[model samples]
Target: MPAYEFPDRLNGNAVNAGDPQHRKNLADVLALLHVGGPQNRAELTRRSGLNRSTIARLVGEMVNLDLVRESEPRETGVVGRPSPVVQANDGIVAVCVNPDVDAIAIGLVGLGGKIISRVRHKTRRVPSVDKMISIVSKVVQSSLAKLDDECRIVAMGIAVPGIVRVDQGVVEFAPHLGWRDEPVAQLMEERLGYATFVANDANLGTIAERLYGTAAGKTDVIYLNGSRSGIGGGVIVNDRPLSGVHGFGAELGHTSVARAGLACYCGRRGCLETEVSLSRLLDIMGEASIDPDDLGPFVVASKDRRLRKEVDRQLDVLSVAISNFISIFNPEIVVLAGFLGELLEVNPERLLERVTSNSFHQLSADVELVRAGLRSQHLLIGAAELAFSPLLNDPISFAQLKA
Candidate 1:
């Protein structure tokens, strides 16, 4: 038996993989590559505390199953031989889908968080559930047709900008998308014959950041995203998501900022999202919209006084929310994505200053505030994590096991 120590479980209690034949043993090895990217066999032995023979057998089994591949080691001027590098197989794919208020993105994501291809279909207006499903099915068909012969898509994941019932994969309410009680995962799985999972888009973003983005190694984190529709958020506590029992946790946009300012879609008044908005920012910029990749710089370099004033006010409202989150969670890092990230880029110093003023003195001192490093593809990669969850857990079933 090997000592199975995951990065998140390195607090001195590494489990012992009970038996060599048990799938837990296989999963432990796979999870290492799946999360940590790649490593040599000797490094794997050091990490797993397994004998050379056990690590070799596990790597061989993974290679035969098409779950991983090995490459010759590069010379580093060391005196001894270097172990071969073993990496997760990128041929195994996950179909990722995200339905925003203005567009829908469908992507083919391979293992190791590689985005093979993505198609973003723009919409003139908010799409109905049936229309959204039709678009997803068509794009998925077109995307899959171009897959390489060695590549296989195992499952589909949907990231929704709305209240989601994760277990049911249903959109309980997406005020911007105008959806209610739609079983998106069930509907898609029935249409495509692949297992499907769904979650709140912001929640997925949090997981993606923790695994592959800015908050890679941090456990406690607070993430806020501003989109065309509105603001959304996610929180991580002690390495696990703080998603509520009903899956409505971290709806920071609805956090009341004013007692009698404006009515919201959730039947609330003066919500944080009501004050700080992406569409408003775009409208102030005197255009319907610009590419998200361009919005931050555009906002930062603009010469309009009105735009600057409105942005300052929006940032003030946002600071209140950020400070409150910091006081409660005291996370090591706070990531701002989407237009919220743009807001930071526009006037990072001003926003952080305001946040610090509102926050507890000690709590505000050490917390790091930064933009999401993944940029426009954060949500898509997050959705892929959802689709890839099952394959990572049960590699034996998906294995071809050919000679």
Candidate 2:
């Protein structure tokens, strides 16, 4: 069995791990820091139920390993001496990638969800797998060269806009990108010399929301991400992401909303994506050539009657889909991300009113419909989280292996 297989037993109770007590302690400390964010030594001791002496020793060891840092002491307002704040070391960074049809976004994300640096590479045309790999590898090499020696690139994570077999790190299909059965993670690992994980873009977005955004501490959520080409979705149930049997379950955009609507690139008619995608909205408003980043301003400033009618039509369709999702998943939160977020920010009342009226009262009453909290960097942060998961879950074994 792998050393990382040990179950989490850190709930204010001591476990008899026999030979692995030290490892358990290390894992528990890291897990607490990751989940609870930065905390003082006293707070860590209280939350982990570990004795102060033990926490101090483990924290010191982690600090020595360049995994945790202690801030300058601050006075506690009482008669006691000041205590130092403890936080995860920012020097440990992960490479995060978000690949889209027009460009690829790459970031160096440090621990504690900090995006230290980022770069965007625009392509004149949709690049092939080999071409994308070459371009991204060069970008990654350049980024690495500019980083300080203390900033270690521990791992890499990629978010692709399509169905992915995450366990195998293979992109099963990305219709928009015309990619199929691509071993993205393996190829990236070979090129970058770091273990890589790949996941669907929307799924990563959902993880970001749950970890550090609007859906933090939420058990059930439905997330929708709108892009120029299409929309993507993810579902979280009981605090766990519901990636279907093949890790392609929450393709909510393809759900049929109209009986005989526009044709979709997925070879379906009336798919929700065809009706409500950003590209479709732009096309209807006669701005098909506008840059995607400028879409929010374009919509806000346009007085086109066609755009108004199209927005109204799509809002109704979106309401129907969201109402259906509410009935099906009974989620605690529904997050609209990307262009969908802009849509909500522009006219939240229209969508909210439609959804509330359409959905069952009892179900919709408790569901909070809101815009995405993470905004622009959610996907990048989500990828970093993927790379950080192994260490957060099994810090001791990971440390041992690395050493």
Candidate 3:
């Protein structure tokens, strides 16, 4: 027998194979119930472009697997026609982890998009590639052990903070992690037994929003996650993440907005990140004699008459960078994550207004700029979404492979 690994063990068989019509039919039904909420058989068939018989067969299989539930029948406008709504079952869970910035966060997520359990652990001082994976693996194992064995781990997602070539499972560059061209997914697969996926941290955040957060199904979305180093942007257009031919399409932080300004982590000067990122903003606040470590006190000071004036002055520079972004992407929504989102919560209308006033009138008119809903969990949840993505379109494939 092949060397077996605990927790990552697979049953060594191909995923389920049903008729193409059945697979497509089931996907449509799940998509409708997932995106549109519980719907009756007739509505599912109508929305999915499938025949009534196909819907019945797929729904029957789903009900047997406990992936969906049937609700009480309700009367429709058509006389004597009572249809029972089919609802998604939240028991099917996915495990996700974010390994970055010297910490790992693990979350158990359900199909209905709820986080069942979440925990965070420190990485101590070690920073090797193997050590990072081990940290995440341990956290996952511990979390899974807590759940009943019947609670199926449908998939796993990982969000790493650097350039991630998902197709290759190689993290090409992570200056912060001190890693270069590491096959993280393969390592995890060998170690854990379950399939895995890796993605750029910010890109995963975009998926989190598209999957369960506010940006669901929007054709055009630009997501920007902030940090002291810079802000990373994820672009989705026409229902796909726009990773360029080289899989690095949306590196917005490197875009030069000023010819003469602070140098960025990527060795560039006056990039938008140098001016608008949370770290840069904190640096500016420090110049005003505010203590960076005491962010709570500093925020309170910011609300004071004299302190708020200084903060607003600094925001003016960042607003210019956002305005430039508006002229280019013209996205329907731009989500701000990381520390910037917290700052925005403290001063919502101000940042919103600043971007609008600075951006082009026409572009700003249609664009809605907002902060991330996941907050500190953004990277962790994004990572989980990445790990689980490969299993989404093929439920039968997973069903065929027994544990």
Model 3 worst lDDT run, 10 consecutive residues: 1-10
* CA lDDT, candidate 1, residue 385: 78
Residue pairs whose backbone atoms clash in candidate 2: none
Say which candidate scores most in TM-score: 1
What's the true lDDT of residue 140 in model 1?
77
Model 2, total clashes: 0
**What TM-score would each prediction reach against the true structure?**
0.91, 0.90, 0.82
Q: Write the per-residue lDDT of candidate 1 for residues 94-201, one digit (tens) a residue.
A: 888888778887889988887999888887778887777889889878887888988888878888999987767779988899998998878887778877888889
Order by TM-score, highest first: 1, 2, 3
Which of candidates 1 and 2 reaches a greater lDDT?
A: 1
| Local error of candidate 3 at residue 304 (angstroms) | 8.9
lDDT of 3 at 134: 79
Give the distance in Å from residue 89's predicted Cα in candidate 3 to where it truly belongs. Answer: 4.0
* Clash pairs (backbone) in predicted model 1: none
lDDT of 3: 0.67
Q: How far is candidate 1 from the true structure (C-alpha RMSD, Å)?
A: 4.8
Candidate 2 on 7-90: residue-level lDDT in tens? 222111233334576776787787677656788999989988889999999999888777899998767787787678998887
**Best lDDT goes to which candidate?**
1
